[model samples]
Target: MQTIDMTEFQSIDLRIGTIVRAEDFAKTKKPAYKIWVDLGDLGIKKSSAQITFHYRPEELIGKQVLCVCNFAPKQIADFMSEVLVTGFSDIEGHIVLATGDKPIPNGAKLH
Candidate 1:
């Protein structure tokens, strides 16, 4: 395993945000979703996530989730993803979103 100093770890701008919208990303090679997250004061950011196996667009709305806010925007197919919607792969290889256990204000930094 690798270890890092607290300062280094803190630099990873992980934050909590809410899913403001989600839709099928039909242009990507893999099945994915184009999602918009409302990060409170940070505003909304976009991401393309390969999470179609376990989630539906309608269900994702208003769901609170964790995100890597500092990553540079990436272009996937025609979509320009602005943030990374963090999650884990399930036993079946489907994604399970990373989310706060309880409701928290959007854009709250993870400590």
Candidate 2:
């Protein structure tokens, strides 16, 4: 794995956001969801997340998740993904969302 210094780590804009909407991305080559997150001060951002294996659309709403906000928007299929929904792969290869145990203010940066 590539290592990064604290300065580089700090440069990444990792913040908390609440999932406000989710839907299957019908046009994507891979199974994925087109999700919208409410990032408080940062406003709502859209992401193409490959989390359908472990998450259902109904269950994702209102869930607070971590996101990488500084990355440039990426295009997936016909959609423009504005942010990255960060997560880890489970033992079974399903994506498990990265989230805080306790509720924090939306758009709060990771320290």
Candidate 3:
């Protein structure tokens, strides 16, 4: 695996946000969801995440999640994804969302 310096990791804008809206990304070739997260001062940002294996649209709403907010927007199908929702693969290879242990203010940067 490649390694990056602490500075590089710190440069990534990893922040906590609350999922305000979620819906199926029907236009995507793979099953996915288009989520809108409310990032406090940052406002709402959209993301396209392929997490259908473990998450449902209704279950995602109001959930707090971690996101990498500084990346450039990506175009998937007809939607433009604004942030990268961070997650890890479970033992079964399903995507498990990255989140804080407790509730925190939105837009709180991960230190």
The clash numbers for all candidates, in the given order, read 0, 0, 0
lDDT per residue (tens digit) for residues 25-110 in model 2: 99998899999999999999999999999999999999999999999999999999999999999999889999999999999999
Point to the candidate with the largest TM-score.
Answer: 1
Model 1, range 1-111, lDDT digits (tens) per residue?
999999999999999999999999999998999999999999999999999988999999999999999999999999999999999989998899999999999999999
**Model 1 ranges with Cα > 4 A deviation:** none
The residue pairs that clash in candidate 1, if any, are none
- 1-111, model 3: which lDDT tens digit per residue? 999999999999999999999999999988999999999999999999999999999999989999999999999999999999999999998899998889999999999
Give the Cα error of residue 8 in candidate 2, in Å.
0.6
Q: Which parts of model 3 have CA positions greater than 4 angstroms off?
A: none
| Span of 10 residues, lowest total lDDT, candidate 3 | 92-101
- What is the C-alpha local distance difference test score of each model? 0.95, 0.96, 0.96
TM-scores for the candidates: 0.97, 0.96, 0.96
- Backbone clash pairs for candidate 2 read none
